[model samples]
Target: MTGDFRYRLERGGVKYACPACRQQRRFVRYVDTLTGEQVADEVGRCDREDSCGYHLRPSEYFRQTGTKPPTAAARRKEPMPEPEPSSIDAETAGRSLTGYGHNNFALWLCSVFGEEIAFRLVDAYHVGTSRHWPGASIFWQQDVTGKIRGGKIMLYDAVTGRRVKEPFNHVTWVHKALKIELYHLRQCLFGEHLLAADPVKPVAVVESEKTAIVAAGFMPEYIWTATAGKGNLKVVKLGLLRGREVTLFPDLGAFEKWKAAVDQMPGVRVSDVLERRASEEDRVAGLDLADFILREQAINV
Candidate 1:
């Protein structure tokens, strides 16, 4: 096979299911440049960079399929540009700002720090109350463009400040619940909007949305944002953190994995604060930055 690449990434909004992860619309298929068709459904790259790193090139596909490659003489058309990421309507997101009074997470925040500071934290992060559960809250992931990408809905106990898992792990997405068909959910870091608000301040990133909120209440200097979970520490999500000082606080037992992932990017550092301080019992419980900060607050009081 001659060195001229026969196919290119099929750009536009038509994403197929990833062959590896099997997640619908996350795979960018490799198109046959000569025919303007896909090499195969499975021949593409998965969009879940952090969790599902799968890329099957056209050359590799042809080799595996035992198909003849397109000769260098075959004319190739340039692929169309990719579509912009989807965003929730401003009106819909605006409507969610209310009803935080019934939000379990918000209620817990108020109980710990009082209503004044609690409301401030809620406003800063665009936290919303969800009627999906009796006392659930939505952690809306807003980008620097002021777009609402999606919201992570989770239920918590107002008194314990811990997630409720009795009736099954209470978690869902706003996009899914709204019945938005073909909704392309591109997750930005939770509290990402704070980067634009406090540009000069160094950024402190953690895994949990609740941790980001509670840590912000205690450490106001750092612009706190969250990866939203352990598996969400993707390069694309952290792209906005470039040119700024960034520190990632991984959950217990996840320090090594997170450090390896972020090591490729310059100007980014993963903190060992939890790793250094946690006891074996704390590690077993999988505690995070919020646990440490909250425990310290309780001890001081």
Candidate 2:
């Protein structure tokens, strides 16, 4: 409407709206051999690029002519759906598929732990399929005797009512057992243990149950639990750190993701866990603390 406006070509039939005032002018229709009769352009200009400082591209005629793009308020992506209750509630029961725990896994767990220890078959699906363990095994620890006579790795599968298959591979079975045991401990003892470990102080957090176990084995000074995944950091108890320090020792692989999230917590301090001299001699390096411990024992023997 003012001298500050000039006509410019946008597209064929689409009207040009001022980038600033958004005032639109009627566009003339035109026909092209290729596109046929189409509003291929808009003619308009703003002398106010200095004061108003906004320009519209001829290609924007599609938008100007068709319909305005949704406002920024509307264009934003929907917030990621809140982590579902199933994911957040580790205690919630999951679907039990029949295929899980179809093998004779009790024999396998007893071999790893001991017959004297309370060992039994559990549904792998119902109890919660092991993220790391292939089949399943008892979830407990042992004493110095390399036996579960005093300790029990109790595995309760969330899926089937029966025991799962035993591993054909010895090394694989051992590794699977350890993994199952670690996760079992986390599912069973972690919340209570970590809370009690230091009722009055902040706790150290690790990413893996084995890591937490190994660290606790060496230094009973701090409380710890692995949230399973880096993204699961929110599951760590903020209440435990009401007015204390939270040292985190994420596995080497998860350091960066862990660090970024750890600092977001109010009083979390990132730290490291040093394996004992035995660990070094055993050439052990992995996310699972059980691996570290087993390697140490093997190397020592």
Residues 77-109 of candidate 1: C-alpha lDDT, one tens digit per residue? 556555676788878887888887788899999
lDDT of 2 by residue, 179-200 (tens): 4332222122232233643456
Q: How far off is residue 186 in model 1, in Å?
A: 0.9
Q: What's the lDDT for residue 49 in model 1?
A: 91
Per-residue lDDT, model 1, residue 268, is: 82
Worst 10 residues of 1 by lDDT: 72-81
Best by lDDT: 1
Every model: Cα RMSD to truth: 15.4, 13.8
User: How many clashes (backbone N, Cα, C below 3 Å) per candidate?
Assistant: 0, 26
lDDT, model 1, position 110:
95
